[model samples]
Target chain A: MIQKEYEKNEKTVTVSVVNFNPVWGDKAANLQKIKTMVISASQEGSNIIAFPELALSGYECGDEARRDHKPCSMHEEAAETIPGSSTAEVAKLTKELGVYVLFGIPERDEKNPKVRYISVAVIGPEGILGSYRKIHLAPPPTFTEEACFKPGNDLPVFETKYGRIGVQICADFWVYPELSRILCLKGARLIINCAACMVGQTGPEFIAQITGCRGTENFIYAASASLAGKERTLSYYGRSTIAGRAFPSFKQIFAQGGDREEIVSATLSLEKGQPPFDQLSLEKERIRSFELCANELKKLAESR
Target chain B: MIQKEYEKNEKTVTVSVVNFNPVWGDKAANLQKIKTMVISASQEGSNIIAFPELALSGYECGDEARRDHKPCSMHEEAAETIPGSSTAEVAKLTKELGVYVLFGIPERDEKNPKVRYISVAVIGPEGILGSYRKIHLAPPPTFTEEACFKPGNDLPVFETKYGRIGVQICADFWVYPELSRILCLKGARLIINCAACMVGQTGPEFIAQITGCRGTENFIYAASASLAGKERTLSYYGRSTIAGRAFPSFKQIFAQGGDREEIVSATLSLEKGQPPFDQLSLEKERIRSFELCANELKKLAESR
Candidate 1:
């Protein structure tokens, strides 16, 4: 496959994304299709390339996913190891194209003996940067994705050539605010959210507000890659989007087409902007106020 | 006192406010001071006249704030019932001026075997509409005023001659989002914060943003009554302000007077503006995106 060579390097932050309309359960064909898209991303000069969650073998595995499920989750069987063929494919392209990539996969946990994790692989210039698992599992309405995937406990922030990087799997951004807070505090100028949201749920507006509020509250940049388009069993909404604090530097989006997938690109500036000190100070006032209110009423005794 | 004869037949939202510079220990002078302010608020056509916290006796009561130490905390100390003395004073004015008045005092909570509450009284045209205790307290380093006050827990949102009315003490606005959220959710279109904030202690920018964000998030108006001039023992910063999504109200105020304990007023239209909801939505987006990095980031994201 002919990979795209990055076109610009003028201190510009660029985004490369691939939108795959894969045939579910066919890992072999999906990999072949992804190879062409990954190459195109490299040729187009994407500094950071991202793919949808569970893109390796497609999103709906059902019983197959169950069989592959680790002791606790379907995600256990999602991916084999860091050096698995999927990693090799992306690593080869990343090394050759000289760019960063964020992809989703299922894997077994090395610790705790039997738990498997649904994590996003963040491959950087040096090697696999790290992985962030879904913290807030989408229980009820979404039907047992958590039954197969073990939840991630620690929040990890990494230093990369671009900036301090923070990553999280799908649904993590929706329920928990602490993860976002931790990332911002760690100086993650940019946080990437790789999600697989189904059709007919709280659409783009809900996603935008959730991500936007978190970014505004913490003063950090947030980018997201969502699954798009539909194939049997699952319909991925194709509007994959990127967001953050810097302009003309971090926006890139993608859509899907027939039989295979397509890659999209954009530019992002990773420079630091407003520090979060002011906002943090602002929140401290609330806590102080809480104490004051309680104390005065106590002195008032029965007043409380 | 020629109390303002406000028209209940008319649809007007009048906000009553009291400006106080506490002596921290003086009650007699503070009481007299509120008497004059309440009379003035009533005479001047304020439908809802309010006062700073503990205006009846200065907020700095320390250990002497308890009912056992002071008769003011006892209703049998019998200032007035609904038409008691303080209530009588406000009622006479509201009835004379045809307006409503809300003022703060040390309330003897008669319900729970003699609890004293630092409360604000809402005196309507007919009688005492209701009372709200300082639910949130101000504790130490919180300055000279922290050690004595007890916090109130139940937040009561009342419906008056105007739209819906939600009354809260000073620091209450800073901590919980639930109070304002409930008010708006309950159809209270306007939120009035009765407070006494210190200079340099409270960041104006943060307050404005919080107010604006709250308004936009809940779709309503926000008004705050902060002490205008420094009273004995306190340096009052008089920049009481009003904010809402229904108007194009923008003002550039760098430094305001540290003196002048007068009622500074503004007319806020609860009526809808000419702009469509979508236009307003976009306008809101633009204003929120004012921070250069966020705006640029949003632009880039959308452009891509």
Candidate 2:
């Protein structure tokens, strides 16, 4: 396996987010585009490169199938298994480039071929690292994921050479704050959101707002890669962002993409030392309050 | 009790937030200032008015005693019982004005005199409606609440003439997102944050960022009333704000105060109809995910 040499002098990782626009339901074409972007980003010295949610099959592929009154939706028709063709292709590319890559796909369950999930696969030079299925499926009149996709149960953090990283899909990052907090408590130093934010329904500003808060509140680095351009009736607002604290108390938007296809990268320092006195105290208090918060959440779940 | 007549012509309720400056450890003088503001706000036709956290006894009263190396801190010396003199005074003012009022105080536990909590009291025309003791305490190095204050155990929602309202203190609203979620689930339409945001440690923008998220995410109205001006060595950044969705998908800052003493008010319509299809689906998904989220939180707390 070919491994790219990272600088041993500095504890920094350069992460890149690709604001991609995929041809609807065209897996082969999308994979070729992804391969080119991944190589370009790798050549740019990015340790980790990420793509938008459903970058392989496009976000509105299922909607098109549903609208056409097809017996099987495009999501089912185009769904790939974890170690299947698409992932193996990306895995091969990563092995050659010697960089970690993350991109979204519709994963077909091996046993139950009918069941599918909105998932992001993380691949390293060694091969398929892991995949995080989108847990919070977007529901209802605006966008319908629940009609076709099943929600994932576990919140898993992937071990990486850069750091322990956690991946979350679009709505999961925007709506639920607890998911990120849980990821933070589980030792995720950097969180990546694979998103496909639609225009009108949810804008880029809202994405930046919640994304920045998640980063600052948990005191962790966060990056989001989004799908730009249009997919059938849905037009995506791609303002992919990387947010972290520049100073200890202030959150800074390190890099942000515009409405068009582009790449945004930021080098984040992973050095650890004793936290400032205020931060230490705040962290201690956060841990202390977790039990109470957990109990309340349990009660809320039970009541529901 | 003289009840203020509310207009039944419309479904709107005017809520006021007082950006206050309190004299350190001077409860009597502060109460007088509060009374004056309450009357002024009531005259301006506000159904509810809120004051900053620890408005009565001042935010840095304990720090003063700590600095002086006194045996008993001002927080201990000046702490009042919930049904104590202060609540009675506020009750009288609210009863006369026939309006609802919320203000923070250091509550001395009736059972245990040594125990004190950073708490907000909600008083109505009838009397002292209820009080929400701050569940999350600010820890050391920035500001020390854990040094003298005990964290509250309960998250309570009080029913008022306008609607059901919930109260949270400074750190509780800023740090813990689940606390507001629990309150929202328990039927709180309006969440009020009583805050003492310090100048250097936390600023106005950070307060606004989290406050807006809490409102927009829950699809509920949120307001923060904060302590302004200086308190000994600490200076408070007072950008008190009220936030809610102006449009269905857009969260708007309805009203915001400056860095000095002021009262900001906004009229919100509380008419409940069937939620939009998008909102309905989102709420359904949120409820469905609660079980999985609670389990994760439980595991996280256990790991610690």
Fnat values, candidates in order: 0.01, 0.31
> How many residue pairs clash in all the candidates, one count each?
53, 0
Q: Model 2 off-target regions past 4 Å? A: A1-10, A62-72, A273-290, A297-304, B1-10, B62-72, B273-284, B297-304
Instruction: Indicate the residue-level lDDT of B258 in model 2.
Output: 90
Model 2 scores what on Cα lDDT? 0.79
What's the CA error at residue B232 for candidate 2, in Å?
1.4
In terms of docking quality, model 1 is incorrect
Candidate 1 Cα errors over 4 Å, as ranges:
A1-11, A17-20, A61-77, A111-114, A246-265, A272-304, B1-304
Task: Compare the candidates by TM-score and give the number of the best one.
Answer: 2
User: Per-residue lDDT for B175-289 in model 2, tens only?
Assistant: 6776777777666778999999878665467767777778877777899998899876678888889986555555667899899999999998776542442355544565556
Cα lDDT tens digits for candidate 1, A79-193: 5565566777777777877778887776556654356566777776677776777655544223445556666666777766666768866555543443454455445666777
Q: Which residue pairs show backbone clashes in model 2?
A: none
**A112: Cα error in model 2, Å:** 1.5
Provide the TM-score for each candidate, comma-separated.
0.49, 0.90
Clashes of 2: 0
